[model samples]
Target: MAAKTNPGRFFEDYATGQVIHHAVPRTVKMGERALYHMLYPARHALYSSDQFAQACGLPFSPLDDMVAFHVVFGKTVPDVSLNAVANLGYAEGRWITPVWPGDTLRSVSEVIGTKQNSNGKTGVVWVRTRGLNQHDEVVLEYVRWVMVRKRDAGAEVAATVVPELAQVVPTKDLVIPKGLDFTNYDFTLAGEPHRWGDYEIGETIDHVDGVTVEEAEHMLATRLWQNTSKVHFDTSARPDGSRLIYGGHVISLARALSFNGLANAQMVVGLNAGAHANPCLAGDTVRAWSEVLDKAETAAPGVGAIRLRLVATKGGAPFALRDESGKYLPEVLLDLDYWALMPI
Candidate 1:
């Protein structure tokens, strides 16, 4: 008799254009938000206070954007990256709508491209995944590629066909949550007075705070999202005997640290691109900084979009991203480019 068990998909199992509907939709609530804040220093006013969100024109506070992302991404791990070597990168991501407490979130992914590595041991799979609300509304969507291991190391894969992806989501494509009017925005309460017009391209702001990653905190956050990546939970998976911190955790950490300078950079509307430049492990002190890339005016009244380059480092000098040869320094943990909304 065949033993009844489940072994997740391997690299050769994927075909370009294949659609995968992930299982187990999650109904997010304030408890997840509370735990997220407890894990990271996430204190954006719009996500923290109903009164503040209402003043900015939302009926009530919404779940933190990163929290929603984690829930959606978590659902796809089993089906997509269960045997992955690495989560490579993200691109062309946008937050379509706000996710509130009690919103049931689900994820669907389509394999857009595949390319086998020369080593014959691994291949890259690119999936465009979306998080949908209960009503079938797309709350968020993005393209991410993962390096996956092959069950048969010498297995042949389809010819390399990497899909063409955008480097930056155009500003016009940035979605504003319904009824979100920042015209009457209260800068006093939002924690910073910098509006969209205040920032200049090439300006850099060093977020002068750091958080030491703790083992328990990362474990709790990873488990909360139901993420079962071995590198994040099993120290035995790596040679150094340290569980690698989830990349999304570092994203939230850097975003939270940006509050010191970008407190009013309210809602994250678009994720243009991101990279986990290096692995983060517990005991590393993470710090952040941001550079103004560009700005654009949106049709929404009193709302504008600002493009930013956010960098996270573990004990590296601020504004230092690359070494002499332009390779990312070992101390650089993340490099993210995104669009955020702010009052005009």
Candidate 2:
């Protein structure tokens, strides 16, 4: 039998119904909140001002849901998808609760299904991962699939069954975070009155701007999120001794960058999927590009729904991400899909 796999690769020396619990529990802090402000230019008074949030009846401005998701999801990359050929998709994703600063976050993934591809050299694995806060409440949960390479091309094929998944989560499945009472939601500070009705299908936005990340900024972010993966810090750990920038840093930066074009998207309604197309290191200037995929009207009087593709990359130019190989060049960091709420 082949030896155990490397830190992040999949090996045939595995079994079905396995459960992989990733290591490293993290705690969020003020540095993360500061970066969220700088990155997204998120004008939500609740997130930007503790006093404002308190006046609005919140104890404090909690981390944005997407930020929480990014922090939680980043932990799973090494153990789950480092060797993935393609990230198939997501289903049954929900943010069950809020993640406040100072909360510790950890993740656990249960292998829901596994199958061998007819091509013989590869297979697909499906997992349901949950993010729990320090309180042990499920803050986020999602089902995802990845195309993984097989250790032995000639290994006996187990099965070829593909699991069924919903293209979009049902409306009832949308778990609005507990204690999220938008009744007191401050519309003026939220930046726009546009709600679920104003966006037109196929609209395009140019969230114009970029921010160059520095060692200090990335390290601060990684530490705040409690993501202790040494590659993100402790530069002396690597052979070249370079620190790897945290992926959540880039995601927040890009989402914040999206504000230029998507200023009206006040609330995130759904997350269809996302990707870290490439690794980003410190000193890279990041910028963003957005394309509206679809739109719908919402029940919120002034709110509308807009599906958007948000892409981020390093210096050179906005929208210039891939090389001739059709691969995400070194500078490209993220490609994400999601739904946002805007004013009509």
Candidate 3:
């Protein structure tokens, strides 16, 4: 008897506006939260201590923002990027609500746009994915585009319509978690006294910390997210013969390193845009820096939104992003723009 298994969807199989409901709803717990901290130097006080969260008006500490993002993003891999060449970029990402330890999450993706590449071997597929809790509440949603291989290179082409995504999430659309009140935010326990007002637009802060990536850590982190991208696991997948570190791993590391200077900038509520400017491999020493982009007052008491440009580099010159020719410098790994909640 022949057994059936999923070979995953190829570029030719996807059409604009197609919706895919992913499988396997995952239930999170304290163990997941604990392991997240161990995997990265994540020490955001609001997500680490129940008492500290209570002080800010949350009933209890919620899972780290990256945890929720990884869990949700993982569920879509098998269905979306199982045979992808590379994840190109992200835009219009927002966390609508806090994901608690007990919450169960699942993902659904809608193919918003697709364009066949000139090479004919692959095409770009853009999807808007939503992560929803058990109660059907949307926890997060974002738009991502990936390069996917075609089942048949000679297949007839269709009209390519690339969806126009916002360059940045509007400040008015940012969601403040229920019961969040930073008015009483404790600077002493929060680890830094710098509030939202302390940061000047365009000010840059270099996080004075670096971590060398290891093969084991990269593999574990990729598996933890259930990310099935072959390039991240199979070294033979790339000509360099080096396993590429998951971009999310680098993002988390950069965010954690920024803690020394941005400890008070808690709660990542918006992701305006992100790009894995260059491939990150094991043995690379990753360093990070942040530039204040903009600021906005949130509807929640004591909670304000501060926009930042977080750049991760492989020992690049501090604040060095684009090269003289307008391309990202080879030493730069990630360039992310997002909004975080901080005490006003």
Please provide, for model 2 over 121-232, each residue's C-alpha lDDT reduced to its tens digit, 9 standing for 90 to 100: 8888888889998888988888877777776688765445456766655444554433334445556666656444445565655566778888887776665555555566
Q: Against the unseen true structure, what C-alpha lDDT does each candidate score?
A: 0.93, 0.68, 0.92
**Cα lDDT of model 1 by residue, 60-102, tens digit:** 9999999889999999999999889899999999999899999
Number of the predicted model whose TM-score against the real structure is largest: 1
Tens-digit lDDT string for candidate 3 (205-264): 999899998889888888878888778888898887987898899999999999989999
Sliding window of 10 residues with minimal summed lDDT for model 3? 1-10
TM-score of each: 0.98, 0.71, 0.98
Residue 222 lDDT in model 1? 89
Better of 1 and 2 by lDDT: 1
* Model 2 lDDT-worst window of ten: 174-183
Clashes of each: 0, 16, 0
